[model samples]
Target: MTAGVQATVNDASGDPLGAHVALVIVVVMVFWAFLVAGLMFEPYRQFGHTGRLLQLTGICHLLTVLQDSRSWSLARVGDVASILMLGLLAHLILTLPQGRIISGRRRAAVAGMYAGVVAATAVSLRYGPGFDAGCDCFPPGPELSAAAQRGLLYGSAAFFWAYGLILGGVLIWRLLIRPHPAQRRSFSLAALTGALTIVGVGGRLGLFVMPGTPAPDGPYAVVYAATLTTMVLGPLGLVTVVVRARMHQASILDATVGDQGLLPPSELENALATVLKDPTVRLTGHPPVEPGRSGVPLRIAGDHVVHLTYSSALDGQPELIRSAAALARLTLRDDHLRAELADNLEAVRASRARIVQAGDAERRRIERDLHDGAQQRLVSLAARLGLALLQLSRGQHATATATVTAAVGELQDALEELRELTRGLHSPVLENAGLAQALASLAERSPIPASVMATGERLAPAVERAAYFVAAEAVTNAIKHSQAQRITITAEIRNARLVLTIQDDGIGGARATGSGLSGLADRVAALDGRLTVTSPPGRGTALVAELPSPPHDLR
Candidate 1:
């Protein structure tokens, strides 16, 4: 050991080996603290960094192997081993939690610098004029360039070994410091996992630094076993705790949503309770439900078409959406109601289909009647009037002239009336143009300011026609019943369903009586689609209708 280090150690420098060992232990302990923390907190990059550290640790182990089998020809090999140990120590300390964690371009630049320094030093150990004996930290050895080998050996031994013991001890004590809440059956899993992850790292590092030296000579084997156990079990313990916590949460959620097939009694109560995280959901109604049976019921004002809704915590939103759907489906389940709706739907189809065919046939008949009957007679009458006017022009009497002029005026009036009648028979423009142009004409003829917007992919012709009719009826109602000043129609396709909305600023008490809205509701129902009206008191009105992508039966 060097007399200078011995003298620096508090006057009584009798045992130089012990003092050197103390210094080695302190340095490695500080470095290990940061590395373990990085492993836990930064986890991903830190674990990646840990993998490199592990490789470095393995490198240190391999170096110890070479240092054991020292040779005369490979005399410079010990300096190479010492340099590798320096790199490994840097590996552990550099990625420690306290160390700056960096990534991407910045990390790459730093890594390149770190590599250059190591490469330069490694090249020097083989070629440059440098210390060539042993690990610079411990055991005074043969002088290469006049430095004691024991001075390096005893110092590294004192520093790294003592530091490893203290680090392991502190972490083990920390594990014993706090007991978990003990509230869950899974608390033991947490306690064991969290403690071991910390203690394992401490122990594993101790084994690496303390062994293969004169000081830890006999105690090395025992410490290594304990440290190794802590290292192996740490991850397993942590995973066990996490898995248990997840399982507990899943069980609680299953109990809340519904235990399989049971339907709830009161939707609103469960919704309110679930929001509050009240242990059990409370359904509305008397006869108090039991065994987690709260649910929403869907039924009509009268009839056995009743069903209750219980749902998984998925798909539908606002909790009550499932209830609303259930009610709609329930309304359709009554034998009589279903039959009536089916008949109503069939009637609508039959009526509109027949009306279209009848209107076309009637249009042809009216055109033929105008040409063959009224138009022919008017043409003959015009010929007769022309002949009489010609007579008057060729010097007829005054009384005859007056009579011909009056007769010509009466023919003109009759022709005007016939033209108005033909226009009313059925609009030719409505048949020639598609629904949008027809609606534009209809809107131009309206009292209110109405507008329509269509976006997204367009719908099938029949669906567009139904939507057009609905908009027209809504505009008409806005003017007649609701006293609305302005109305807007919006149509779009979202996720294969066609959505049509009619919104109006009007006095808001509109009901689905036998008028066109009721017809629209029946029409949508016939398509196996849905119709909803939100006309809140004093809040104006909105009518929403959704139809399937393929509304009409393909057959």
Candidate 2:
């Protein structure tokens, strides 16, 4: 009532939804932006490429354009923001070639062209024209119009962006309509971000080109009353979104996950296979991957031996070991209590492998059952029904009457059962509709209460599969081990990777190595993924797994 009254009795008139709500959205958005800088660090970071960061970036950028945007014009900040945005976009485009998938100069060249525009514009502002004014893109006086080519070039870039947006919007439409795309990984981050930037550009200027403008005496008059607001805030939105991507990646690396690039791939692989894979390896870091693959194969040298305290609490008094011994002891257990924990660890490991194999076998068995059993029955039944109908039409009514009626009804039931079986066994919706929908189905069917959230605009099949399996495993574990009430599963795709997180509020003291969670980590690692289990004795268990989102999505 208060809001309605204030709006009704307001002195100004304009777009209430557009101006007022847009302004509030902007304020809320700007405030929400603190999270992104923590997520976008490096590829291997813990906080890297997350969903919240991505969403915040997009929202905050749009919010800056709502009202009083022009007053934001400050010294070199705008230029720096523009440069960072252009660099980020250019990096995205250029990295496609570096990723070795594109293997062509075309995309890289496009990146260079965009970067060149930034450089040229910067140079023109400094030397070619209006050198006295600071790095502000918008000037208040008549002298600002003197920098003609800079404006034209900048405007042209915006126009190109608008074109890209139009083209991308079409692609988004296509993906949505025929979402069960035959191909996956066809979509890229570069494409999504570019499309968003284009949308931002066109949206900011869309009103002017419309058939008619809202009366200037309306609510938005307060919003557009100052030219600086739009000029500064409009483009800032795009910049914020892109920069936020970087921040997200950075934050993850430092806080959540370490920069594994510090170790060579082979070495890190060995370390994980050796220490981390050990079923008996308590909450410690140490191991030998395989029987002969131990002692750091001559080929694998480096080690990032971050301390891992193994069962120090329940078991009491933790022991520390060097990189090599830690790796060995962590896996095989070389201490006095090792014998006691051995059976438990082995059981955990065995259960982990068994669950994985059983899941696969179940799927195969169900598939075979359908193919060999129900399908054949349906085919035969269909033929029998058809033959009966033919006989009845040919004036053999008495002969065909019972058989035709029975066969027809049987066929309908068989088909329905097959459909139900299929839905339960494996979802075609998951395969065709993609991971997000598949997870939604899983959440609905979860015996234990569960909530699932998917983050990517689009996902590759491998990623979708990884996410599906991870959630399945997590939920299964929650039911069998944790005795938890609710499980929350989140799948976020960012920078060619998918991070799967499953958490439950249940009994504490759940050990990853001794419980189903340890095996879950091993499974993820086998697929070149990483898993982290955070279960403080009394706190709820939080499980996180990171899997490589294929550079090329194969649907």
Candidate 3:
């Protein structure tokens, strides 16, 4: 076990560069397979050519890499293989998307490209200098001068890339003139692939054209680097095209599933037509007929039709005429009841949320009434008690003076307690002014130094009440239990929700289930809001609450 653990650690700490390159190569191979699979399974036969050519291209590139493992003399065989692949690529580009060649002239041009590659490879094997010794004895071979061999190599390189440039021009033209959006997307991918391959070709041509110029690396190195880069990116380009096509298909399916029951019958027909990609799609519901005599018929324009029969149990029900799209019947059949139930469930949830909000509003109203009415009256009573005590203290009734003073003190205490209770219930500032002012009042009243940072448009009354209560409870708990030096309350409105957070710098370990915090949570819940308290040992407590706030226009 110890040795295994040490080995695992060593593997985990292995050189990252080799691991990364391996991962990239594996991903590229997977993407190559995905692209080929997407093409091979395409619905149309016209795309078969491009898919087959790409398959050949992938094979040729793989062989090129494998050639590096062979002896250099044997590796020369890959030259013609590489040239044939490029010729095939040119053909693929010229006839992208629907891969059938458009005209005889275009077909002839593709044939000429392949012919040129074959002739050049033949010339190189015959008249050109050989890489291995066995070729010295071959008969009927032209013995070319070194300079002539160099010129032949340069000429071949130039011709190959010039053909590539022409193919690139054809791809660009197709992209510009293609009328269908789907075909244009495929053309775009073909164009990008062509461009990258052309760049690599141009790099090779550069070496041939400048024999006297010193290369940054050896010829083989530059060619291999360019080839590897194209191999990696070409698969990615094809995969992008495949992904986009699948996404478009998925969107159609998604629309069918989502809007089946929502649209009117005529509108639903149009929607189905869009999803099925057949504009002629229509629906015609029929009255119940003899159970087996004549069933429902589903037809796609210019395609074979299918008849669906109703069971004896469903004989009395109206016949649903589903769209020709596969699975459309399943979506449309008996969906009304499900849609109605869904709407009812949503309405119930909304109603419950409103009731919770109304409770919070009622609480705020009571708090406001208590503060402005009864609390004010009590304040006046406290003033009267103080006046009576002052008068008795002046010696009008010496023995009763002490009793009045004590009673006056008690009244003063009651007034203070009432003020605390009203603040806790709901801040008068929150009702009249806004949440910011209420939070500021809270910060001022907190035993520890506290600050309020709030911004954004004023929220609804219920939202304000919920936020105020949570902040008050959190502040009270933090000051009472947490030996905090300071507290901070932050409030903001975002995406029509009021987010309020309170934090303290003190000994932590506050629990959400504590009576004060739990009651705060209940108040928040009554407003369809959420409250969370987070405190860890040695980390100060924090409380966050989120409340739904309708738009100002809505309010």
**Residue-by-residue lDDT tens digits, candidate 2, 176-285:** 33222211122333335444543443343332222233344443333233322322333343344345434433432332223632333224334433332232332224
What TM-score does prediction 3 earn?
A: 0.40
Q: Point to the candidate with the largest lDDT.
A: 3
Ranking of all predicted structures according to TM-score, beginning with the best and ending with the worst: 3, 1, 2
Model 2's TM-score against the true structure: 0.28
Q: What is the C-alpha RMSD of each candidate to the true structure, in Å?
A: 16.4, 32.6, 23.8
Worst 10 residues of 3 by lDDT: 313-322
lDDT at 148, model 2: 64
Give per-candidate clash totals: 36, 38, 0
Candidate 2 displacement at residue 112 in angstroms: 62
Which sections of candidate 3 miss by over 4 Å? 1-46, 66-77, 123-140, 145-151, 175-179, 182-190, 202-214, 218-227, 257-265, 268-555
Q: Report lDDT per candidate.
A: 0.49, 0.50, 0.60
- Candidate 1 stretches greater than 4 Å from native: 1-52, 69-155, 173-432, 440-459, 482-555
